[model samples]
Target chain A: EADIYQTPRYLVIGTGKKITLECSQTMGHDKMYWYQQDPGMELHLIHYSYGVNSTEKGDLSSESTVSRIRTEHFPLTLESARPSHTSQYLCASSLGRAETQYFGPGTRLLVL
Target chain B: QKEVEQDPGPLSVPEGAIVSLNCTYSNSAFQYFMWYRQYSRKGPELLMYTYSSGNKEDGRFTAQVDKSSKYISLFIRDSQPSDSATYLCAMSGQREAGKSTFGDGTTLTVKP
Candidate 1:
């Protein structure tokens, strides 16, 4: 099993509600990433962090923002959720750039 | 154009049959290739990782990378029913900041 952990394996929320998806890694990895995936489809990189206080947006445009105040923690926040935001969000971390990445269980979000 | 391309296959095969999954990448700068397996409603798990060109074997899984052709493959020997899942191919450059591009996963169903 991977060392990364994501809370609320499943979540259903109303539209326009503020939500935060938590991701934490105990493996002491420096590189963290967030990906959004539709059911049985490709995963799109949404956000990533190289180290503390360093975060960058990925190829895909996302309304959410992420912060990396600590090395082991990278949380994604959506100020106001929408129906289009319903998807599976995966969290992963790697020790370095070219190393193997470990993924968390993922958080499934549903907006109604 | 997208950096990585893969067949979104619902490939069905009998148990104990050898399974082959492949992906093609457009970026010549990509040197690290990886394959990840994701179960239903779960995050993806790394199955194989290879650097540059060559083949690497681990247990029932073998990863092959061809830098010249910008192609990579994952072969599973003696596939079992438990091996049924979505296989995703990912690749990226050496830089720590470069985002890893993932292909649309191929779903495999192994039947006994």
Candidate 2:
């Protein structure tokens, strides 16, 4: 089955902790994206990748970074987590730039 | 003003009722519109997608786009408890289809 997966569905970390969220898709998509969303709030794009070795910062400036080393994997890392970083991180992939995106189950991070 | 604006609705309705969700955009260049549904603590799943200005219906879900007014809507007939979730509206232009602008989602609950 074609699907996107994110690990560590729930996380709790203290301030200044380094953390990484893993995202992978089995659909062999070329476009991948990372979005930050608060519970019942708007979603903000944080990072995206057009293809392997191609990455760009999204509309919302984020403190995290992302890498697209392979077509199936796009991981997000926070250098130093803060309480303000407590939010849900969503990963999504698309076959093409104009195609609809399929999202993962999401990783919820709670930084204390 | 924001590129896309959506009312943050925590709307509660009885089961089998007709439910409507909407969003308005400030950009006239937007040509592609989409709706995504997110359950509690989960990533958004694409529900409806349309290009240009028109209406598209699939099963009990109907998506409408009015480019002249820069607005879009989603209507769900005979809403069920499974329909309880947050609905997000996203839009982008044909040329820059990868950079989609998203609106704040509206939360809906269908009670049995």
Candidate 3:
């Protein structure tokens, strides 16, 4: 099956805790993206990767960092979580720059 | 001003009604337009996609793009209770299509 997966659909943790959100896709897509979306707000691009060993920061600045060691994996790590960092993280992938995108279930993180 | 603008509406309609969702963008470079459906606490699922200025249809959904007017629309016919979700509009430029701009989703509820 061609799909993208995100681990820990829901997470709750105290502030200042370090956390990593995992995203993997079996579709062999060249373009992968991570987006942050809050309630009733638009999605903000946080990070993206074109392929293995290629990663770039998106339009929105964030304290989180992403690594694309392999083509299938793109993980986002927050050095220290804060209460203001609580939001849903979505993962998406596409075959080409102008193609349609497929999304994963997403991970909802809560920093108390 | 924002590049893309959408009405974040909590629109309610009876079953079998036709639903219309719209989005406007300030960037004329955008040539790839898409519509996505997102359930509560779920990732967005692609519903329809169109290139340049034209209409594309699948099942009960139709997506329209007007590059000259810098506008796009999605129409859903015979709305059902299962259609209750948030509709999002996204677009990217043809030359620079890797990154897509998304609109603040419009929440819709279909009653029986």
Question: How does model 3 score on DockQ?
Answer: 0.74
Shift in Å, residue A73, candidate 3 = 0.1
lDDT, candidate 2, at A28: 84
> In model 3, what is the error at residue B62, expressed in angstroms?
1.1
* lDDT tens digits, residue span B1-112, model 1: 7789997799999999999999998999888888999999989999998889999999999999999999899999999999999999988787643367889999999999
Q: Evaluate model 2: give its lDDT.
A: 0.90
Which of candidates 1 and 3 is the stronger one according to lDDT?
1
Error of 2 at A78 (Å): 1.1
**Top model by DockQ, which number?**
3
In the range B13-104, model 3's lDDT, one tens digit per residue, is: 99999999999999988888989899988899988988899999899999888888998999999999999999999998877666788998
lDDT (10s digit) by residue, model 2, range A1-112:
3399999999999999899999999988899999998877788999999899999999889999999999999999999999999999999888776757888999999999
Residue-level lDDT for A9 in candidate 2: 98
Model 1 residue pairs with clashes: none
After best superposition, candidate 1 residue B9: deviation in angstroms? Answer: 0.7
How much is B58 displaced in model 1, in angstroms? 1.0
Please give, for residues B3-111, the per-residue lDDT of candidate 2 as tens digits.
Answer: 9999878899999999999999988888889998888887888899999999999999999999999889999999999999999899888777566788999999999
lDDT: which candidate is best?
1
For candidate 3, what is the DockQ-based docking class? medium
